[model samples]
Target: MADRLDYGEGTDAQQFVFLLPEYLKDTSKKMKTGLMFVKLVNPCSGEGALYLFSMCLQQLFEIKLFKEKHHSWFINQSVQSGGLLYFATPIDPLFLLLHYLIKADKEGKFQPLDQVVVDDMFPNCILLLKLPELEKLLQHVTEEKEIDKKKYYKYSREKTLKWLGKKVNQTMAALKTSNINVGARVQSNAFFSSHQISSDKEEDYICYAHGLISDYIPKELNDDLSKYLKLPEPSASLPKPPSKVAAQRQKRNK
Candidate 1:
């Protein structure tokens, strides 16, 4: 398997070899001009959805998140590649959406933002000590002597990934309700299918400064991007079941 390029956190702007900054600049201009590049199916209608999306992006930059290389890479790749690399923005969109909710709460929208929403919005910001609050459970396991630590880690990781996937789908649905669509499904599937982390994972995870490399990325770096963020690969489609009548006919012929 060929290695894929991973721009880990992309902190420096000087390393992008094949990236076209002019395209990013043009996109920002278009986004500001209220032009609809992608079809949106929002209830807000007109330019309200675009305005809100722009506002979110603006607020994101105001908070200094725009300096984050992941975001820069996301914005550039998304536009330069024409949405082929939409997932390059590994940060959850909800994190950005939280700013809007916070503003709405300040204005007495929806009876103030809930504490749960605050934590959801700022998971990395909150600090807690010790076990904090605990909830008791009625059911008890009789024998819990031996669980394989590796297996437990794998199981927990799988469960967490599953939960995150559902949340992502729900967020996408919510964004769509607001008439915002991010990427084409076909392109997304192709991205996932082409990038898989396996035995050569160590070499595959090498972090490269985008601007420091040559004008073009190494061939290995073009095949995978697991170092930037870990995501579940899209599953290969299952084969369709054979038709029963056809199977019986074939058996009779045999």
Candidate 2:
């Protein structure tokens, strides 16, 4: 019964279905999958939805699909490829996969079965984490004191990667059941001097960096990615203005 479910229903759904035959035919084709590394500044803690998702994937996918050679290449290539540089932050691996999936889906290059594959593995991926929780997690990490900065950053990065690996494993495990060969690997590259992490402008810099990656993504996938990433929406409530009485009191004092 689960095999009959059609998980593709958005604007580009039909295009994905149309591409399935090609993927099926080229089952033996080997393509080098690349993950451009960017450190995540804030990550959801505890049983944070994204963290849980990552944990699941690591247990299920990465353990099975990722080969040593492929993993090495992914990390090595990013350093060689060269692009806009930014400070490394702790990022969930599943989030990275989702980003790639969004890019492929938007290009109409992803197969429908692949969507089903994602659904089976991460049925509640987006639902698990709320926007506020995600935002708070980032704030918590970035707001740490300078004295404990290195320790906090290391802890966050390790924890984030651990969960991410789990998520990748889970996703791959689900794909294996469908006879799909899916995999994930870790990659790291040297940070460029031009992309130094500035303390004062970190927030805006990170936001813009994420936007740059999102911009290159196809339109169909952009909305979904934004939604998943908790990007602010136009209809979201604006912050309340200062009280008139408080404003008047301050003016009088001045």
Candidate 3:
């Protein structure tokens, strides 16, 4: 959920509060010039999304801002209105690579990873090719060939489905272990002093994990994953969601 901010019409100066991983501060000592913000394709939306790239660490981070109407923050010496809290989370580079591979798949040709990743609109996509062990990561979702000692890859639907299944399983296990309340039966008893929420139904875990995982892939692949997992059809009455500011798909006029 990376965001690209814009100064809205007639907007006032605002303050930002961020919660970041400690590792970033540690990594900063190695190099200063390699840190930057770049726009690249969002694996889930196939749209421009902002990301923070560290060429030194070869790491990519997803920035997510949490905003609420009429919120304000009081710093040590001043009060700032429209204050928002942001988080920096590590993103799986493979997901981003898969986005390009799926698009390249339409060409019906095995192409070198570098050739396949070129983006005219978001040229910084080349930085992704610099990530370490990229060949090993691509093995999860691609079929490749070696030509003249160079490797070429094409998206492998079979392999990708298997990989996504594993992702769902991993997310589901975390949900269960964290004692998340995902079922209506659990939430309905929220006010009861004697209630326990960890006993949610098995389907609850699957649905919750699917919702979270869907944010990282395109709608078509999401639908395919749903079917592959045999998830029950979602009800049409519920509207989709994500409230954030961005020039990306996640953005809306604030």
Candidate 4:
């Protein structure tokens, strides 16, 4: 058989398993950023990609913020479907990941899974959002009491573009940095073992919540995923991902 990828929930849903470190195995102690597993019920299509990509960004935000001292903002569109907007800081991802991870862990979602596969699934898409545009959305959403769905989508699209443009500019600047100092130095090590080191050579920039970089995944992996995903074509507006060296540098910096 196909190894029955279904995790009791359904076949369409993808379940990711994360082994908790020995320190996190204790239920009595609380973890600030420990995730056991994650389940994506969305279909593996464009729509599903959007939500999954958003989740990856959230995780990256949390990882890069505490470890790298970078910060950004995000609002869960799924939560805001009821017309109430809740802006979250990058730190919020710690809690968000915990919530989903706990649920999946309890149900043994996709138990006995390969950790490598799960790790590879992350950074599937890099979104370059402008900090100022995020600020604008935060201001607008907080001040406004009632927002229709139509207006929300329209506003999100507009602001997202502005954010992406600014993000591109920032990445370009980082690449041009003669000293090669991407941002503030990170004293502490990353919590996740898969964290990448930044490369010396500049490539495409993935404007994540905490900071920006490129080559989140291996070239072969990206090429494979490209077969299924209709990712945005490389354009002046959208920068390409960095080379393998840049990815290594990202890991080292992390």
Q: Which candidate is the best by lDDT?
A: 3
Candidate 4, residues 108-148: lDDT per residue as tens digits?
A: 33322122113234433222221124424333211212344
lDDT of 2 by residue, 1-254 (tens): 00011233773221000111232234233121111111221112112121211221121111101112221111212321222111111233334333323334444432332241233343443332322344344332122223432311111333333343344345434333433211111011111122233222332232333333432233444454455445465321222222222222233244
Candidate 1 has an lDDT of: 0.25
Q: Rank the candidates by TM-score, best first.
A: 3, 4, 1, 2
Sort the candidates on lDDT, descending order. Answer: 3, 4, 2, 1
Q: What global local distance difference test value does model 4 have?
A: 0.28
lDDT of 3 by residue, 50-106 (tens): 777767567887767666668665444555566465644568888899889999999
Total clashes for model 2: 19
lDDT of 4 at 15: 26
What is the C-alpha lDDT profile of model 1 across 1-254, one tens digit per residue?
01112343655211112233242336555555432122211111111111112221221111001111442222333432221211111222332322333234344322212332234423422221111220111001011122443111011223322333444355444433433212222221121221232221221212111111211222232222222234334333311222222222233244
On lDDT, who's better, 1 or 3? 3
lDDT of 2 at 232: 61
Question: How far out, in Å, is residue 179 in model 3?
Answer: 1.2
TM-score of each model, in listed order: 0.20, 0.19, 0.73, 0.28
Task: Give lDDT per model, in order.
Answer: 0.25, 0.27, 0.69, 0.28
Off by over 4 Å in 2: 1-132, 135-155, 182-254
* Residue-level error in angstroms, candidate 3, position 154: 0.9
How badly does each model clash, as a count of residue pairs?
Answer: 12, 19, 0, 16
In model 4, which range of ten residues has the least summed lDDT? 80-89
